[model samples]
Target: MRAEWVLSSLSQALLCVDGEGTINYLNAAAEQLLNCDHHTVLGLPLESALPLRSDKGEALKPALLNELASAGGEVKLRTSGIDGREAVMSLKVEVVRGDGGEPAGFVLLLASHATASSAAAEVINHLDPLTSLMGRREFERRIDNLVNDAATSSRSHALLYIDIDQFKLINDTSGHGAGDNLIKAVGECLSAELFAGDLLYRLGGDEFGVLLCNVDSFEAKATATRLVRAVKRMDFVWSNISHRVSISVGVVLIDQYTLERQAVMSQADVAMYTAKENGRGRVHLYDVHDKNLSRLHDEMDWVHRINQALSKNEFCLVNEGIVPLGDNARADACRHSELLVRMCYKGELLSPGQFMPAAERFGLMPQIDRWVVQAVFDYLIANPQLRAGEVMFSVNISGQSLCQESFLEFVYRNLRRGNVDPSLICFEITETVAITNFSVVTRFMERVHELGGLFALDDFGTGMSSFGYLQELAVDFVKIDGLFVHDIDKNPIHEAMVRSINDISHVLGKKTIAEFVESQVVHDKLAAMGVDFSQGYLHGRPVALIHGAGQ
Candidate 1:
């Protein structure tokens, strides 16, 4: 027991392999020393955990293990993780004997400074521990240096983003061990194709980045095509089960025109997705002029910006008034407005029209919606003036958020935690979203109504058969779609649709708000038609939520 405790306590990694060469025990330090967990390797053959190889990249021979009984062998340790880079380790093996003086098993002790070895630490920092690839950090740094290098030299380079096709299938069907083996094999296959001065790195899960040095567009495309075919030709066998694997390649040329490291990476990623979209196991060379790739590139750019906006507290709230149309507009309506979100990005306040489509496309709307909700809740807690039930703040939610099962809990928790006036908040979702996710939306709205909160269906008249949807949804307000409202005066069909929606909503005990009420003509027209409220330029423009509209 004491010996076991001592073995467990040792800072250096240790492993015990039975005479049959199966690992029976491993210390905690061994996990970190090799960047591995015991659940995958314990009770398995030592080679399953450590596929040791030599300087020539040949598998360590079985004869070497038998020789370790007398004079121990030294070999570099390898345990592939995400990156699969390895470091040199000093291995000393001692044979354990049974009472009959026969070999029971072997105790392999690690003797070296894991942290104290400067050479190992340097390799660990830059090279991936599982395979020979450099790693993502080094890949980025090298790109930056290479971009700067392009200014002085006339040599061209290219960035290729390689992604394993259907990698998740391997993990799901066979196991993660097979997935790891596939990664190692793919790395080897790719490395075999590298030219002198070319670099490769494991960019991330099932993805690799290759920096092809001294290659023009023609040469770059040729090389990328070769990479795609090479992976297709690889006959990867894991655990005696052969699995077919292929990779999609996206290539972006690097020249004097190359701007920054991130943009280059983004382009490569976009191109890779393009290849995958077309069909897996192909190559797509990025062309800035291609409309589809260009649009995807822009969205990728927004994805980065949106991530930054969330982390940096760059999102701010604004409100546009929703004033009643009749003579008693002020007394009946109070200070009602719909909350709008703006991003203070890169020294410019960008409206939702600028960034929202991208956010929705990339499934970032749920995160943005949460940020708005928490911000509004926290803001009300901080300021007493915004707490009154008279001032209702309507917030827009996206369909992606409605699909999330925990989103309702998140909203409920914040509302309960802050003790903010429930009636002062109104949640809004597009008519399309509310219709598609009808069941979840109904449950969410019913809960809000139960809490004395309100629900609004925004952009109401755009859908083909929305009147029927209105009959089922217990929404407190319906904001006529801006597409209809913006040209309501000029388009009689739009005006009639607006009037019909307004009358139906009133019959259902719900108020109606006309969006895009740009001119007095439209406002007066809405008033004459008995629209309950107006929200747009004519009534009021949006102002920062911290300061209320000047009544």
Candidate 2:
């Protein structure tokens, strides 16, 4: 009964066949799979008890199992049940030899196709193909189990987040093959140093995560430091060039306080970044009250929220009128409406100021910017009246997006695909973005110009080389920075800064727009200085960008 219970619980079906090809025993799983009870088929010939055909539609007899009793191997066959159900299974035959070293009987193990495929998929999902290290999915699984264990017991676990220092330099100089080789080498080096029970994972890119079980805080720190020192002494050789490698580690102790995997991972990530920030190739122990951790936790929350917003279509747009100021009533300003994005999170509408920093830090700006472009283009498609000629729309592009060749190609495809006039759309890039991605930004501006689209240099007068970059950007509008405009009415220094920016922009044939025009006094001063347009709360607040009048 005990042996029967064990065989009954086996996921794979099992059977026993004598050398004479007669079935003598069958487990519960085998009975169900063959669509018969063991009592009904135990004494029957194996071929007659459960008739099966191979994948090629050829019937295989019971004598095939007798032959496999000596040369053990497997065969693929499909069994058709009495209930009109069919199952494809791989059957392995093991030789049950007698004490005389002669074949006596055979033991059969059968795995259904569905079960085999699922097992293969589990391996693919949990492990990274590049380094053969467990990936984030596996990390979360083990950590969640450990967290649950910690809740009921005093068991302690430590999480160490490791990032390869200056890894981008290797990729940039040696190409991706070299980078991949280095990653694999690093994984092996780290794995060699881990204890038998320790867990290591590749958390994507040049980052790895380690889980140290049943360790105290002091031991966890020492382990993290050892790993860092181990990595420091390693040399990775690629294509005849020998390069030194190092990793910065962040160690977080998971005691009774860890609520979930995300909390510990985020804390470890925060500590890892701090270690990198305080100069790479070291370990930083996570403190509950660490200021960096607190800031990073908030940013991590925002990152999750931002991703949710993008996927759920909770992101929306509003418009603030970029009204023409005085005689400088430029048609470009009159034709354009500033399109600003907001997040409809829960019941509240969040401005870009609330979430933009997080979006920038985690490299989500490219995705967000792509979402905005597609959304704006979709809106224009739905509303023909809003297309380029009558009312031009200006959308802000991120510095991160500006640097990608794919993003530039995406913009070009949209411009050529749409019915909307390219001349009616304006792409606003910040002065800092233009300067930082100088060549890429220049190439983008040239392409947009060729397609008849307009460019606006936003947040002007902020950079030290603001005027110097302005001479080369060829933007239709130079938006004066709000820092200088916010206090233009009170401070002469700010007034002079705005004045000089406006004058330089005009000399280069670029229209100037003053931002943060909060009062009539500020408005009049900007108009007197010949600023072409103004956008501020005093002129008009942001209104829902509906199909009709609200915009």
Predicted structure with the largest lDDT when compared to the true one? 2
Candidate 1 residues 1-551, lDDT tens each? 23654454345678888888888888766765666677789888776557554445544333455575576555444434457666566566778889999878888766443543564676578877677688988788778766754644575678889999989788757888888888889999999987865788997789999887666888888988998888889888877888888899999988888888977888898999889878899999999999999888888789889999999989999878888887648458477888889999878899999999889876798899999999888777666665454688889888988887667789987776647888888999999999899999999888778878888998998776798989899999999988888788899998888889999999988889889888999988888999888888987579887634332
**Shift of residue 252 alpha carbon in model 2, Å:** 1.5
Candidate 2 residues 1-551, lDDT tens each? 24643454344679888877788887656766677777788888777667766677664454666654446666677988677777788877887889999888888887777766587788777889998888998788778766765664567878999999888789868989988988998899899989876789999999999988778889888988888888888978888899989999999988888899888988888888788878889899999887877888789789989999988988888888887887857544345678989999889999999999999987899988998888777777777765445677789999888876678799899998857678878899998888988989888889889889999999997787877778888799899989899888899999999999899888999988889889999999998988888888987789887654424
User: Model 1, stretches more than 4 Å misplaced?
Assistant: 1-117, 127-133, 144-157, 163-200, 205-207, 213-248, 255-263, 273-282, 288-303, 327-333, 345-347, 385-388, 406-408, 547-551
Clashing pairs in 1: 80-130, 84-130, 84-131, 85-128, 85-129, 85-130, 85-131, 86-129
TM for every model, in the order presented, reads: 0.65, 0.73
Q: What is the lDDT of candidate 2?
A: 0.82
lDDT of 1: 0.80
Q: CA lDDT of each candidate?
A: 0.80, 0.82
